[model samples]
Every structure is written in C-alpha cells, then in structure tokens.
Target: MSLVVTTNVAGMNSQRALSIADRQLTTSLERLSSGSRINRAADDASNLAISEGLRAQIGGFRVALRNTQDGISVLQTAEGALTETQGILHRMRDLSVQAANAGSLDDDARGNLQSEIGQLRNELDRIAGTTSFNGRKLLDGGYRTVFHVGADAGHTIAVDLGRGTSAAALGVDGIDVTGPGRYGPGAVTLSTAAAPGTAAVLTIAAAGGSAGFSGGTGGVSAYTDLDGTISVGGRSFDLASVRYDTAADTDGNGTRDAADLLAQLNRAAIVALGLTSPPFSSPTPGTLAFAVAEPLPGHTGTAGAPLSASAADLARSTPTFTAAGGASRALTAIDAAIERISTVRGDLGAVQNRLEHNIAKLGVALDNTAASDSRIRDTDMATEMTAFTRTQILSQAGTAMLAQAHAAPQGVLKLLV
Candidate 1:
C-alpha cells in the first residue's frame, strides 16, 4: 500500500472504530449503574412503551387492592353494628316471653318489660340511623356502593343493603305488650280467619275523646254510635248514626246479633270500601275483631280519625304488653326482627369474604405485572457486566490500533531520508 501524509485513512478508520467501542462501553456502564436496559426511548422504543404500560397496570392493581381493603372495612363496620342489633333483638324476645306469662306477671311487671322493649327499639333505630363508614350510612336502607377490585375498567363489586334495621323497618315499632288482651279493650282487631296472614289491633281509647266500644259488651250490645268515620286504605266509611244491631241481618240467620253485625261490616259495599269478606269476628265474648283488608292510615287515636286495621297499621302500631296475650304477639314480632337482622349480618359477612378474595386476586395481578415490566425494562447484571468487559477490551485495542495508524506516516518520512 502506498503511504500518504496528507490524509491517513487508516488513522481515520481506527479513530472511528475507537469511538464506536467507547460509545458501547459508556452504554454498558449506564445500564449497569441504572439497573435498567431501556433508560431512554432510544434504547428500545417499542419495549420501553410496553414496559411503561406494564408499570401502569401494576400501579392500578396496587390501588385496587387498597380499595378492596377499604371496602372490607366498611362491610365489617356494618356487620359489627348488625351484630349488636341482633343481641338487642334477642333480648327483646326474652322480654316478650316474660311478659307473655300474664297469669304470673302483674301490670307493673309487664309495664317494666314494655319499657325495656321501648328502649331497645329506640336503640335499634339509633343503630340504623348512625351506622356508617366513611360518612356513609350503611343500614339506613339506602346504602349502595361499588368497589373497584381489578386493574381494568368495569372490574368492580357492588354492595347494597336492602333495608334499614330500624324498629319501624323491622315491624316492631308499634310493639305493645300491655293491654287487657291481644286486641286491647275498645281496640279494632284485624285478622284473617281462613288463613294465617297479616293482623293488626287498633285500640281506640275513650280517653282519646269519644266513647269507644266496650270489650265486655256482648252480641248487639257492643254496637254504639261511632261519632267519626273509620278510614281504611285511603277510603272512608261514615259511622255516623250507624249501629251494629240496627244494620241488616247479613248472617241470614234472621236475628241481628254479633254474627249479623259482622255480616253487615263484611257487606259487599263495605268490602268495596276495603273491608275483607268475613272481616269481623268475636274471638272472645264481647270482643270485636275486624280483619284488616288493606293498609290503614296512621292511628291518631282521635275521635275523628279512627283507622281500620291492616298489616301495615300493625307495623306502625306500638305494642303494649300490658294487655293479656299482647306479650305473646310481641314475642312473635321480636322473633321476626331477629331473623331480619341475621339475614343482614349474613349478607355483610358474604361481602367481606368476597373482598378478601378480591385482595388476593389483586396481589397476584400486581405481582405478575411487575414481573412482566422487569423482563421488558430491567437489565440482567450478569449479562450487562459481560458486555461491559468486552466493550472495554475493544476500546483499548482500538486506541492502540489508532496510534499505529498515526505512526505509519513516519515510515514514509524514513524512506525519504
């Protein structure tokens, strides 16, 4: 090869090789120091994008796990409150059973029991009203929420508490185990004789103004002029100048007696006014029982707003255990309330379990996603070190070669001398 001093191409080529090797060495060092292969988009653009996506997924999974935990906490709070409510309901049941022993317990004893029941009922209402999580009421019948349990959109769980645990909601608001009988004197007793169904006894007391019906008045003697109208299911029936004995002999037995009075009350016209067929019955001597046909209006106990009985009215009626058999009925109501509370607690427990599973799932997803990101974006220390060693050796060798190329022009000068 002919040698030239003006431009030593060999030196230029050696310098270019050295520059490439030095760049490789620098890159290897950066990878080793940072512990990342794709520090910049230029390192591997597509893989960098993929790694970023995986990182985002991992972040979402972490947040979802936290959300599931929070959801579980909320459910636990609600369930804990319900457990207390169940205890109260059980106690109320015991009180009702105790009050039911009318032969042994006197008015004073029964009255004390009723007082306890009232307090317990109030407590139930308070629990329903006050039970909350994160400032959201859980037992007021309006609790409905969603928990995000997954990294992807629409991966959620819904929680809804169907109804409130209040006394009114549980049909124990009007529990009164105190009275002369289960229906109470002068009270309108509503029941279904043919089948077991909803029943209510509305006590219209003389102390509330008009002279109410006498529990001792048997047959037609029980009939009296009700000064006001009795409303049932929003329909009103005028009782003015109407006497049970004077009404038509509806029993078809000819004589107008208690049965006739019941027949008149169950007349098609009255039935059309929301009174069920054969609605009235005398469960005992001188006692008037009116089977509720539909929901009754609020029992104001005033002379003008006498309401006919229905299951809905019973739910709103406060129970007085002071009357005979009143305690037995209250016991039944307490049992029902207990069952309701149990159902609510069960639902809450189920939700808690589901949330636990959700947390596990989120953890697994986060782990897998993080691993995937590591594969795409993280450098292997062993592999990177090996590459660094090779690049370092190449850099040194290229530098030496560049020096040789630069000295080659001196050989031409020696020939000239």
Candidate 2:
C-alpha cells in the first residue's frame, strides 16, 4: 500500500480535507449572506414547511385587522346618526307636553300648536328618510318591531309609523248603513260573551259601523243610560244603554256572557265597523255598545279624531288643520326607530370588541409563530463565523501540503533520471 512518492498518502488526505473545508466555507457564506439556514427545500424541508405556514398566518392576521377597522368605521357612522335622531325625538316630546295643556291654550292657540307638531313630524320624516351612513339607513324604523292589538292566526296588522306622514293619521269612516245586515246575512248577534244567542242590542249605532248598510232610526228611547248623539253617514242617532246579559250565548253553546259577546262583537267590528267619525266611546263602568244613527251625507270627512286633535279644533266647529293629528302615533314610531338604532349599535359594539380581542390574541399568536420559525430558519451568525474561520484555515493548510506532496512525486522523477 506504500507508494514511491513519500507524500502521496498525504496528498490524497489533503485533497479530501480541502473538499470538506470548501463545502463548509460555502455553506457558511450562504448563511451569512442570506441570513437564512434554509435557502431551499433541500436545505431543510421540515423548517421550510413551518416557515411558510408562519408567513401565511401573518398575512391573514394583517388582513383581519384591516377588516376589524372597517367594521368599526361603519358602526361609528351609524351611531352618530342615532345620536342626532334621539335629540329630534326629545324635542318632539317637549312640544307634545306644551300642546297637552288646555288651560293656557285657546282653540286658535291649540291649532297653532298642531301646526308646529306637523312641522316636527315632517322634519322627523325627513331625517328618517335621509339619514344614512355608507349608503345604509339606520333610523328608518323597519329594524326591530312589536305587534299589538290587531293580531290574527294568518295575518297581523303591524303599525309602521315610520312610513313618514302617510301613517301619521288613521281615519275611521262613519258606519255606512244602507239597510239591515250590512256585514252579512243572518241575525246580527252583538253579545257580551262568546255565545251565539247573546241578546245584546245595538244601543249606539256607530256612524260608519257597517259597510253597505244604512244607520237604523233609533235613539236613547230604545235603550237606557245613553245620553249622547252620534252622527254617521249624514245621519244622527241618539245613544242608548249598554246592557250585558249573562244568558247571551255568543259561542253558540247556549250560554253567553259579557266577555264572550264583547270579544266577538269587537272582533267583528274591527274588520268592517264604520264611522266617518270616531267609533262609540266606551262609557264608564259599562260594557261595549254600538252607537246607532240614521243615514246622512255620504262622507263627513275623517273618523273619530283623537281627543287632542279634536280639542285643537273646537272653535271652528269644522276644525281643519293642515297638519295631521298623529303626533302621538309618530312619537311611538320614532321611539321604535330609536330602539332599532340602539340595537344595531349594540351589536356593532359587540363585534368591535370581539375584533379588538381577536387582534390582541392574533398579535400573541404571531409572535409565538415567528419565534418558532426563527428557530428553524434564522442564521446563527456567531456559529457561522466560527465555522467559516476554521474552514478558511484548513483550506490554506491544505494548499501548502498539496505543494509539498507534489514535490515527493517529483522525487520519483529524480530517481529515474
């Protein structure tokens, strides 16, 4: 195994050493320059996978934070509009209180007060219609709602006061009584209980209580405890008494009472009962009674105006105010609108808070993931420098030994000479 060249064995050894040194130097140079241990998948596949995953998470976090900011912006805009709307409602309420006092206001004064109410209603409608943030209307009253009074199995009447001035006033027409049985053919049963044979008579004929039927020619002389005159369809009838019989069978079960008949009658009346004026007012400590009146002019204008509205127009006899008398109703509607705004704001606040919390959590998560990625891919400069210096020295030594090893092979040439 010995060679003639004394340094041949050393030459091969030095060459192998040089190759190892060159490889180490190249690796150190790459790490130092690139600041990464995993320059390629072959360098470290596991670390490459982990590093890429961390990068994707960082990108998603940044995008999510941006989205949270956008949501907050929209919520803030809606909140601003709601705050202004609340002020408007408060102003309307104050005006209502001013108008409610009768002692200080004459008919003219009350009429003027109603004019102001009309203006306020217009303004509220304008605000509701126009107030929008980012092209979305928040105070427009369609958001959250509650139904009362007129509820049925299939259809329910939801009073939407937010339809601006259209819903401002509701008019109940006078009962157009053409003849008997305007609603339908049969013994019209008015009862105090839910019985079919309830012996309740029409005490006060509502002017617009029935459709296609004429008001019956009867007066307080027909009944008792009624002392008011009501007009319907151009006809007037005096009020009579309201009697609740326990034997009235409104349910058709042979037994009738005040509660059942009243329910049935009111339910039936609600659907088609007419009066160009307000329906019969329930007398104190008495049951429900229909106001009877003879036929008159086909139309007497709007129905039972609210007491506040009627009171406003007493002096004129035919009080006509351009502004409608649905301010109370409007107040209710505006309140509902405000509640809707608040509900949306509350939801937005919750979302914003959650986003903030998520952002904080994401920050922590990003930090941990970055740390893990760094451990796998980041260069250790000190370690790299140490290896680099060692490799440099070994390469230099190998070159010197190569020269000496070549001289030994030259000695073989000398021997041949």
lDDT of 1 by residue, 61-170 (tens): 98898899999889888888988999999989888878778789889988999999999999999999999888889999999889998888999999988778889899
Lowest summed-lDDT stretch of 10 residues in model 2? 169-178
The parts of candidate 1 lying over 4 Å away from their true place are: 182-324
Q: Give all candidates' CA lDDT scores.
A: 0.70, 0.47
Runs in model 2 lying further than 4 Å from the true structure: 1-9, 105-294, 297-336, 413-417
Measured on C-alpha atoms, candidate 1 has an lDDT of: 0.70
Instruction: Return the lDDT, model 2, position 50.
Output: 80
User: Residues 141-212, candidate 2, lDDT per residue (tens digit)?
Assistant: 543332211112322112222322111311101111112212221112222322333222333222334211
For each predicted model, how many residue pairs clash, with residues at least 3 apart or on different chains? Answer: 20, 54
TM-score of 1: 0.70
Q: What shift in Å separates residue 110 of candidate 1 from its native position after superposition?
A: 1.2
* Cα displacement (Å) at residue 299, model 2: 13
What is the lDDT, from 0 to 100, of the residue 224 in candidate 2? 23
